[model samples]
Target: MTLQFSATALFAHHGGFGINVNPFETNLINLIIVIGVLVWFLRGFLGGMLERRRQAILADLSDAEDRLTRATAELTRAQGDLAAAQQKAETIRRDGVARAAAVREESEKRTIEEMARLKEDAVADLNAEAARVSDLLRREAARQAIEKALASLPKKLDAAAQSRLIDQSIRNLGNA
Candidate 1:
């Protein structure tokens, strides 16, 4: 209440709040006094507060920088690992392709060799069968010739010749 009364009295004494006595000088002097008192009382407190806030901001910045570095290192390592995996995959794929080609070539070679062997076997079997057939044909021809000779031998001889031969055989038998 006294503060309010004193403020009212001061304002009343200053020409009743009007443009009479050039209030700029009085108001400026009052503002300067108030600001001076506030500075005098609160300077160390404000300075300490500003210093603590600055340290906190610096610490946050340092922490952010460290996190960024760590994140960058992790990204680099991940990229390296990805590249290594890709290289390994490529190597494996190449090896698989080479092995498949080798296997196919080997299989083809084996198939050809097997075909050749089968052809040789077939030819040998054909030769053996031909030889057996030839031998059988020769035996059949010899048998037929012998039968014909036997069938024609009596027809080829005459009756006179047979009588003479019989007389000679009887004489030779009497001598024996």
Candidate 2:
């Protein structure tokens, strides 16, 4: 075939006018072919890129969830430890208070015992002193009575008369 710009020229110039081609119908097959190849190429490259981006976003979301879970677990453990520490502190406080009370009670009991012992000793000393004073008073009274009787005796009484009177008085008192 000969290369020509117009159909009439290719036909040996025998026609004055030729049939015109429609724009829509002429390019329809070519458009379908070109668009098909383009769709095929983009479906692999661009679709894979979008898939990777989606996977990366999902991985990030999962990592965030894991970190939140770990943090919550740690917080719960710390709270439990705090509660245990508080309980231990309260127990220690109670024990200390009990020990203090016991010490106070012991001191009070010792003090009372010592006071009672002191009171007993004081009473014993008082009884001894009273006995000593009573004995001294009795001895003094006896001495005074003896001295009065001796002083009242007459100085003029002769030994013989005194002896005879003492003997006669002794005999009469004995009989009575």
Off by over 4 Å in 2: 1-39, 149-176
Tell me how far the alpha carbon of residue 6 in candidate 1 is from the true structure, in angstroms, after superposition.
15
Residue 52: error of model 2 in Å? 2.6
Model 2 TM-score, 2 decimals: 0.58
Candidate 2 residues 77-134, lDDT tens each? Answer: 9999999999999999999999999999999999999999999999999999999999
Stretches of model 1 off by over 4 angstroms after superposition: 1-30, 149-176
- TM-scores for candidates 1 onward, in order: 0.66, 0.58
User: In candidate 1, residue 29 scores what lDDT?
Assistant: 59
Report every candidate's CA lDDT. 0.79, 0.80
Kindly give the number of clashing pairs for every candidate. Answer: 0, 0
Error of 2 at 135 (Å): 3.0
Model 1 Cα lDDT, one tens digit per residue, 53-136: 999999999999999999999999999999999999999999999999999999999999999999999999999999999888
Q: Please report how far candidate 1 places residue 30 from its true position, in Å.
A: 5.1
